[model samples]
Target: MSRPFLKMNGLGNDFVVVEARSKPFAPSAEDVRAIADRERGVGCDQLVSIEPSARADAAVRFWNADGEEVGACGNASRCVGWLLMEASGRDEAVIETRAGLLKATRAGERRVSVDMGEPGLRWDQIPLAEEMDTKGIELQVGPIDAPHLHTPGCVSMGNPHVVFFVPDAEAAPVREVGPLIEHHPLFPEGVNVGFAQIKARDRIRLRVWERGAGLTRACGTGACAALVAAARRGLTDRKATLELDGGELVIEWREADGHVIMTGPAEVDFTGTLP
Candidate 1:
């Protein structure tokens, strides 16, 4: 039987979303690989499944292009939220995920704002291999005397992340270094890597290497993590506009609630049926 699906994107981070509430869609790792393959299947950074939920509007799950199941995906959440609101003709949508409950609201036009919840600051919270200061971990690359990258602040916005504040984000070696840090011994679980260059107290230029999805045009959680990491390092304010490869996302680490709010645009690229 053919299953209908939606092709969506949030700041060029694309996804193939299937509504599985009624039919119960469960794709195995191989199945996911076939669907996410750019040359042979529908191209996307990840695959999102929207399922039935008793606690919220829907329950969402994510799988990377490598067919690895992940706990959270901020960009996909926004896309799913936009779809939910559009279908219900409502301004808000609540969602459940492996990470936790998340709420999405219409910001303006195609823009969406998601409450990413408080960041995990502690070493154990981030679940590092050993106890240490997450603000700047003692990991380095290149020569010992003068390492290329060092002291990355780690945070968990549902998923683990490590942000390296750099003098130039554009010049950062993302593909070369991202995979290395992602599998570093310090992070028991693989980590998403981000390189950030502070433009101002309110602006930052960033690039991210997602744990399972590799380098993408944008990553919502990565943006949030970068802002929080920057704030923790006193490099930037509590909020900033993160300029990613695809576009910009405004991220705020709210002091009152400590909930990170991410605002960005979502779009419908097309639709197709899974054969």
Candidate 2:
């Protein structure tokens, strides 16, 4: 049987979205991997499914290329939100995920602003291996006297993230050091690694090594986490623009509601049926 699917992207973080609202479509880990394969199947960073929801407009799930199902994916959420709005002819859409319920609103032409919810600042909320100051955890890479990366700020934007403030994001050894920190014992559930370079009080350059997807052009939650971590460290303002490899995202940690807002663009690549 063939299943209809949508090929979409937020920034450059792409996804293959399968709708399961009317029919149950659950793909196993191996099935997800096969469909996400670059050559054999429709390639994507993550595979998304839109299912029925009672508490919200829809229920969504995310699976990385490695076939690991995750709680939330910022970029994928935007694409889903867009799909919902386009289908129902509404300006706003709500989605339920493993992370929690999220709201998405159209932000100008071809852009979406998603309320990512409050970041988890506590040690247990981030659920690290043990307790540590989230503002600047006690971890590093390289020599003790002079480590290449150290004292990173941790935050949970529906997912665990460790952000290291580097002088140059482009110069950071993402491929070399990303995997080491991802599977490190400190993060019990694994972690997304962000190498951020603060360009100004309102701008940042970021590169992320996704927990299960490796390095990619963009990471939505990674961008949100970077802004939160940067603000906690006093390196940048509470609201800033994160320039990712694919594009840029505007993130704001609202003081009043304490919710994080991530604004960016989502695009359609092409659509086809999966055999």
Q: Identify the runs in model 2 with alpha carbons over 4 angstroms from their true place.
A: none
lDDT of 2 by residue, 1-275 (tens): 79999999998899999999999998999999999999998999999999999999999999999999999899999999988989988999999999999999999887899999999999999879999999999999999999999999999988999999999999999999999999999999999999999999999999999999999999999999999999988889999999999999999999999999999998999999998
Cα lDDT computed for each candidate against the true fold: 0.95, 0.95
After superposition, the stretches of candidate 1 with alpha carbons farther than 4 Å from their true spots are none
Which lDDT value does model 1 have at 31?
A: 92
Please state every model's RMSD to the true fold in angstroms: 0.7, 0.7
lDDT of 1 by residue, 142-207 (tens): 999999999999999989999999999999999999999999999998999999999999999999
The alpha-carbon lDDT assigned to residue 39 of candidate 1 equals 94
Instruction: Give the Cα error of residue 102 in candidate 2, in Å.
Output: 0.4
